[model samples]
Target chain A: MSSLDIRNLEIHVEGKPIVKDFTLNVPKGEVHALMGPNGSGKSTLAKALAGHEDYQIVAGEASLNGQNILKMEVDEIARAGLFMAFQYPSEIPGVSIANFIRAALTARLADNEELDAARYYRRLYEKMDLLKIDRKFTARSVNEGFSGGEKKRCEILQMAMLQPHFAIMDETDSGLDIDALKIVSHGVNTMRGPDLGILLITHYQRLLDYIVPDKVHVMWDGRIVRSGGKELALELEEKGYDWVKEEVAVV
Target chain B: MPATIEQETTNHSIDFDREVGNFKYKEDYSYDAGTGLNEDTVRYISGVKDEDEWILNFRLKALKVFESKPTPTHWASKDLESIDYSKIRYYLSKGQQPSRSWDEVPDDVKETFERLGIPEQERKFLAGVEAQFDSEAAYSNMKARLAEEGVIFVGSTEGLKEHPEIFRKFFGKVIPTGDNKFSALNSAVFSGGSFIYVPPGVHVKQPLQAYFRINAENFGQFERTLIIADEGAEVTYMEGCTAPKFETTTLHSAVVELVALKGARIQYITVQNWSENVFNLVTKRGMAMEDATIKWIDCNIGSRLTMKYPGVILKGRRARGEVLSIALANNGQHQDTGAKMIHAADDTTSNIIAKSISVGQGRSTYRGLVQIPKHLKNCKNNTECDALLINTNSRTDTYPAINVRGNRNSVQHEASVSKVSTEQIFYMQQRGLSEAQAMSLAVNGFVNDLIREFPMEYSVELKRLIDLQMEGSVG
Candidate 1:
């Protein structure tokens, strides 16, 4: 069974603390949701876990299946069965989506092994179809001149293709309409099974409504203040962030 | 003198005014340029060639004109003053005769050409090849099929001997030696370059390439090339150049003239990867007659300094010219290349696109000229020049001269210079590519549109060269 453990994690960006003493664990066969408001450090926790260069890990420990992720490089952390779907994905012009994904997959293969173009295309078309994406998108540059909905869907497509042990999706529902959210959630839901674990970071309960999680935690000021079952998301959404602030202040 | 001879004499006079004497080869063959230019050198060269009295007198007169002409003073790069005429060994020949087979050539010279992949390319792709060692072609060959088709491929010296009438008619018409300082030098001692003639209504599909190599030190390579495509014919020619790196710089001055007759099309492509120790100054021009087309596809990858401007003259109504060029200047290189188009007939059109990449203090400049005479009722021109600087130390300059004398002509010119931003590199590295790989990808993308014009093999080779240039370039 695969597992990820974060203990006493503290993150800083530009000399300011963002994620402080945050601890979480998700083993295989389960999905966890970290719900919080704006400026609550949830996204910071996700990025720092993914080894983003901009986020400095101060006094924290992150391990992926017994390997210290914090000690690895960005690409090394990625190839080590840890995937992070960014909130604002960068647009790389002149690099086609097909070639981008192919390079990533090529990196995962052994040095002597070669990617079979025929089989690769067949599988790519199948996943794109499942996500309701046109096959012509393979020729277009990666996320270049793409709509917000297309970008989010492309992120999900990458997660499905990479098939990591644990994925941290940050604000996957941002800027998506009802139909896009359903399609994106469906792609993630189809990939869910006993061999995968997901940490879904969202500012609202709208995304959890589609891809139901096994556990939900309310985070305030970089720390988880409340924990419950999936229904916790609905209650938080109804009561708004003020309720979380009041609950945390009382605690 | 007869009217024809008088006209010829006047043409020679004008040529002499613009260039140095052509007898530099003859003098070197006999007495050599003794310390400096003198009447003895001119007489010795004319004596060796066994030229007519009129030709001898023309050389003497051209020598006088060359002596009177002053050196150019307005060069932007002040380093031109370092070329000492007296110090330069004008010409040298390994053999008195041009060999028809590679086996008959000299050993050292043949080995030099063979090591540069000339023989391999000739065996695989070319229908003919003229290999020049110094001032003369050491070996030349043409397929029997092409000979049967009346395709004449020979050395320029052979052209001067066998086809004097055609050679004399158009030799100095396109670009006279007086056009530039280097042209003057080339005219004085120019020796071996490819001379191709496609008979009327016969098309030569394969390329006719020439390989020029500089073996000896303090030597100069002045090769003169002429290509004429007859009516209803098509030809594509490619020329490649190389030289062994030497401590003292070698001068390579070449003059190339092309003529495409009515309804004819000619595409001239050059991939110059000269070592970064040679001064390559070449003047190549073409005249497109009525209903003809000319295209120049040039790629400059390595050279200490190269100044090449391939020009096209639209002499016939509805003639067209286009040039797609890419120049990559690595360390200690300066690539100054562009195209020139002169529209003289109605309904003429020309297009020029140039791209350059500068890295590690390497400099690149685009110097282009487009002219449409007032007499031409309807003419069009479109010029685009783009420069990409790889580092802050590198620089690029664009000097485009657009002269439209008639109101009916349409001219468009656009230029942009940009340096590869750090943001671009960071973003690419974030996608898992190395810094070097990212730089290469960005450079490739910058010139992707122009590179698509090359053949598959050439495009692959160009990418490999660019990758080599980008390796270890990041700080």
Candidate 2:
């Protein structure tokens, strides 16, 4: 079984530590929710694990399915079965979503081996339908001038197509309306199975209502201060983040 | 932080230099006018062509004009000062007539065009083909169906000899010998370029193509082309050019004139991929009559320095013109290209869109002009220039001169300068693309809109060229 393991990790941005001594282990067949407020190093951890050059890994280790992703390049980390769904997807003007996904899948092939175009398009159309995306959306530029809901749906669509061993979803619920949120949750739920592991990051507890997480971790400052089962998310939602600050102060 | 990004761009630009160089071909010239240009060179070229007295006089007058005019000092780049006119060979050719069959041409000459996929394209898509080797066309042919439609496609020399009634009337009328210094030079010693004429109300469905190859060292290629689309006729013409890599500088000066009569439509396209040692200076202009349409689509890549501005004159009421061009300047190259629109009649409209990319120490500039007189009522013009700089040393500039004399005329000009964002590259990398692939995709996207304007086959070829250039730059 595949798993993503982070051990005593410390990440810094511009020479300042953001995520300190963070540890998390997500095995296949389960989903873990990482709930944190703004500037709590949630996005920093995601970027660091994705091998972004700006997020410096100071005294940290991240491995995906027994492969040390920290030693690999950004593209290599992606090809090593780790995916990071961005909070703010970049706008690639003139590049269609169909071509982008095709390139990603083509990268996974062995050298000199070409992807089967007919089969690839068939599978792509199927996944796009499952995500409720119109076939015309494939011709539009990647994330260019897309609404908040469309961007989130696009990220989930990519996750479904790439079928990575582990996916780190960063703020996939932000800016999405109720209808869009349900559609996005449905797409994510449809992809969930015994072979996939998901790290769902969110600021509010609303996302948990749709896709129930097996584990919930409260991230304060730079580390996870509390962890529990699914009901903990509801209790934290009712108590508010101020309660977590006070509890951490007491600790 | 900006400095770091510039450094990365510089490192990537070196990769392109490694990818394109050292392409050479064997040279065989039966007649070489030798280096230098003067009355003797002009007289020799005229004598070899056995031209009429009027044509010979025209060459002499143009030679005098070329001698009187000096190279402009106020260009976007001062590389023009390095060109030595006396060191340039005015004419070089195999001294053979153009053949309609590929087997009749010499093997070496045929192989060059074959490698460039000329014959295959002619068979598959083109209605006619004209392949120029150095100073003269080596092979020229048109389909029988097109000939039956009264479409005239032949070398300029053949056109002048056989179709004097049409050739003489519009020969130098659109672009005169004194239009520019390069035009004057081309008028004096010009040799093999395509001459096409479409009959009235006839439409040539497939494109007519010409391929120009310069194989000799220090040789100069001056081809004069003229196309006349009669009233209500429609046609599309395309040309591609290349030269062998050499240490000594080569010169390519061409002059092209198009006349679209009343209600006629003509589309002219050129793709120039010269070697870095070649200096490409060209003058192309078209005249659009009442309700006529003229369009110029140009793509420039490679060459040490290129100075070309294709222009259109809307000389009659309701005439239309458009210019869509793309230029890429790699290391040690400068592309100074743009368009000119002149609205001389009522209800005339024109549009210009130019895009350029500068990598390493390369430079690109957009120089354009638009003129609308007070007498012209309801004239409109739009111009857009976009520049992409790939490194700190890469540079771009825009100089637009617009003269609208009437209050009823409307002219809009827009320009933008941008670099490939690092964030975009990072984002693509997160999707499993390598750094080079990411940069290539971004560059392709930057010009994607303009590329779509090209014909299907040319657009595909352009993408492949861009991919190769990107790989070299990033390597």
Candidate 3:
């Protein structure tokens, strides 16, 4: 039951099909790389599974830990242990990072229960120290005036605090430079364990060089065209996605 | 156009009912001036208090002015026509005496104030406390230490009789009867508000608090408050008003005046939570002298229609004034609130920041006025007003009139109206918060800076009031 499974999932954006027959499954304790070029529907699939209102799910089923996720509301789905790190997270002005994460944690509590402030700060500081984020960042507003690298680190910081069962990293490596990439990759590698299954969506194989995935799947034309080990990423990087397109065409 | 009057049944509901200022006890009155507003009603009230001849003439003259002027129908809301002046009880009180101790107060009155958490708050932080029920102050007391420093804090009636040398000078000077129709009515029938005077260089460290409660049906509560801080003195005064829900409409019109002399400071704060059946029309203005500072921290949460624009008149060189306010308007309510700054001398400065949140069909309007005459120099003002509309039906408007004639003066004004974005709401929702909780969080974020300007206890209570009003607001 501790797994993420998507079975023949079909999705449309503004009445046009963007993800077709997306079938994948990742058991807990594994990292899966969803590799694709631009417009290959990797991000659309993540948003659809997370129940974003703009994404339409035409057919098929998506479940997490034996619970149907796409059938629930957005917040309910999140409470059922799903987290998405946006490529461009919003800037919540006037709300500090400490308060924002506290609100999220408070929402997870029962009606009669309350969050222990001292305990929460202790755990938050521990995570921030591990991620190498400055202690003063706690007082700063969430992603407000943050650089691209800082925003991604903030997302990982939230993930570390929330402790979600499964996470979808939507291009977490898109806007980072080489040095920032190393720090972020180290964070992802540290968060990896049997308790959390991750679907890492990326266009290039540069990220896999740092945090190697257990399996890699290539997507093209809104469908998965190839499935292989980490070596497939290097092969695609060498021969490029054109070879996969021709191979799929020949099939 | 004088609109017709009709009694509309209470239709829509839900703004923190039953638990927060929604229960009223029976009324036991020793004096009632009957219904209607006339010369006889004014005379009857003046006679009950055994007022001076000059005070009686002032009341009678104000009653004439009240009858002569009309509601500003051409510019005001149509809801103003719903108020029936002939059917309202003008005056009602148990007695003119305000007990100096809670033990001497009536049981029902003491129970009412206790339930509202008055005495506890007084004991916790206040330097002085005045609890007013219906038409008179039930209990008024100040710390003995403060009294030892020659600080005068008492009901307006007692102040008028005991300290006329100081009270008679600035009684109605700031906001006279003919200033507006409501002010005229309040001047004619004003009762149990606070009167405070701090001596020169005598600083009151803790705030003096007054809590006003309305307990009778179809009665109008008109209180008058005045405070004068002598040269080099500093004081902060806070007041709260609450009333129970009733089927008929209730009117609450008050006039408050403040004076900060040279090198002095005065801060006036109000946290009002009137029921949906009340119409709160108030006039509040302060005067700041040379090198003095005056600040108004107002938070308006509940009422049927509230029209208050707390203003400041800078009357001396190097004087400063500031007004920071937050308002939350729920269904069937309209908050027409803003600020005014009048620069009367050179080197005067003022700043105004107002924020409002409109939920459901509620409406909020920000009307500000800033004036600097051509002869004045080095006058500056900065005005900003922001509004948040919760849903599609929720509405907000802003009208700022700024006039700076002299080339040496500088003024800046900014206004913005934004709706709660679905994306922002969804972002908070995806963080595991319900829709209403998410909305409340965003609103609190919108007004977070102004909330910090409030005192510790009021800020907490204000946040709770905002959360309570945000219930059932999500469409």
Range of the 10 consecutive residues with the lowest summed lDDT in candidate 1 chain A: A91-100
Task: Arrange candidates by TM-score, descending.
Answer: 3, 2, 1
Q: lDDT tens digits, residues B3-74, model 1? A: 222322333221211011001121223224433346675565455545556555655655555556665547
Q: Give one digit per residue, the lDDT tens place, for model 3 in B1-475.
A: 0000010011111112224577888888999999998989989988888888888899999998998999987877899999999999988889988999899999988988888888877887899999999888989999999999999999888888888889889889888889899999999988889999999999999999999999999999999999999999999999988998999999999999999999999999998999889999999999999999999998898899999999999998999999998888889999999999999999999999999999988999998999999999999999999999888898898889898897999999888888888888777777777788888888988898787677666766777778777765665
Q: What is the TM-score of each candidate against the true structure?
A: 0.82, 0.93, 0.94
Off by over 4 Å in 2: A110-112, A115-118, B1-22
- Consecutive 10-residue window with the lowest summed lDDT within model 1 chain B: B14-23
Task: Report per-candidate TM-score of chain A alone.
Answer: 0.98, 0.98, 0.98
- Candidate 3: which pairs clash? none
Candidate 1's C-alpha runs over 4 A off are A1-12, A18-35, A39-86, A89-93, A99-127, A155-172, A188-201, A212-232, A247-251, B1-75, B79-93, B96-116, B131-139, B214-219, B244-248, B392-394
iRMS per model in Å: 12.1, 7.1, 9.1
Clashes of each: 2, 3, 0
lDDT by residue for model 1 (A40-145), tens: 9998887777666788999878898889989776667777788877787777655667766776787678879877766677788789999999888987777879
**lDDT (0-100) at residue A197 of candidate 1?**
90
Each candidate: RMSD = 9.9, 5.6, 6.7
Q: DockQ of all candidates, in order? A: 0.16, 0.40, 0.38
Residue pairs with clashing backbones, model 2: B15-B472, B16-B472, B16-B473
Residues B436-466, candidate 2, lDDT per residue (tens digit)? 7887788778898898788766766666677
> In candidate 2, what are the lDDT values of residues A16-62, reduced to their tens digit?
99999999988888999999889999999999899889999989788
| Per-candidate chain B TM | 0.88, 0.94, 0.95
